[model samples]
Target: MNERELQQLTEHISQQFFGKAFRHQAVFNDRLKTTGGRYLLGTHNIELNRRYLEEHGREELIGIIKHELCHYHLHLEGKGYQHRDRDFKSLLKQVGAPRFCTPLKTVQNKRRAEKRHEYICTGCGRSFIRKRRFDTSRYVCGVCKGKLKWLRTTDSL
Candidate 1:
């Protein structure tokens, strides 16, 4: 949704669930990574990750709004507003709001680059670590003209 729609949705959620009005602004933050939404402690404004809405749809967006509203309402009232706080937990349970935003599955499963591999000489029993894989058939041990056996892959030094 657009910024205007986001603002309206935030306000609507705040009023519907918290029984209070959201006086501060609500806007889509493109730079937000990992988190679905965040409440600015200093400004009392809420910034939502637009990717969350686009990927997860309206229901997930509403949950994030409610979760953020929990923080917003509790912090504004001088109650425990942080995730670990008793008041926050109780309010979340009462409102049936999610305790934490569901993380994007794609983000969680990102593959890291392979960094190292271990190779051993079949004849000499000597081991070698290389950053890149070498053809086992052509490459032979310097110490002995023995076949190279692939062992295991490692991340880094």
Candidate 2:
């Protein structure tokens, strides 16, 4: 749906679920990455990722709106609006809103998993897997305190 429809839907959900009117703007933000939607702390406006609606459908969009509304209402009331807060969690449960939105397939596909670097201790013959490479001369093995040698680098599964 367009921004107008989104604004109307957000207002409806806020009133229907929280028994409060949403006076701020709700717009589809194309710049949003990874997140399905975000509640702006400054303006109290809700910015949603349009790609989420396109990829996940209407129900997902509704859930995202509900999630954002939870933040909107809680923050306005001066309660705990962050995800870790008790108020936010309870409100999310009460409204039947999702804790986290499902990741978009396209976004998931674009992210590359971190590669692991394999190393072996020359003296102890012990294998080590690290996220980043370290200098063999500076660092020694914990077991035998021996020099380390680079073995192989593999993509993390």
Candidate 3:
């Protein structure tokens, strides 16, 4: 759906679920990487991750909207709106919103499958793992001062 549909849906959900009208904009944000949605405190607008709707479907999108609405409504009402607040927790439970968004599998897999450069000491057979590739010729083993060689990298952490 477009931004217009999202705005209408947000207003509908706010009235249907909370018995309140949403007075601000609700739009799909392409820049949101990890979160399903976020409530902008300054503008009182709600930004939703379009990836969420594409990956998890309409139910999840609604849940995310509900979650952000919890933040939006509570913040506007001058109640405790933070995740740690009792009011936020109660409202989430009352409205059946998820406390946390599910991690995107593609993102999680990319993190888990990071390429780690491994090195082994010839003398001690000790292994060292690093995030970046390093020249073994310039660096010696710390324990035995032995020559180091590049080893095979693992697929997962």
**lDDT: which candidate is best?**
2
Q: For model 3, where is the 10-residue window of minimal lDDT?
A: 105-114
Candidate 2 per-residue lDDT, tens place, 1-157, comes to 7789999999999899889999999999898889999999999999999998899899999999999999998999999999999999999999999999998899878888889999999999999999998888899999999999999999975
> Between candidates 1 and 3, which one is better according to lDDT?
3
For each candidate, the alpha-carbon lDDT, in order, equals: 0.90, 0.94, 0.92
Q: Output the TM-score of candidate 3.
A: 0.82
lDDT of model number 3? 0.92
The better-scoring model by lDDT among 1 and 2 is 2
Q: State how far residue 17 of model 2 sits from its true place (Å).
A: 2.9
Give the runs in model 3 whose Cα sits over 4 Å from its true position: 103-112
- For model 1 the local lDDT of residue 34 reads 88
For each candidate in turn, the TM-score is 0.72, 0.83, 0.82
Model 1 score (lDDT): 0.90
Top TM-score prediction, candidate number? 2
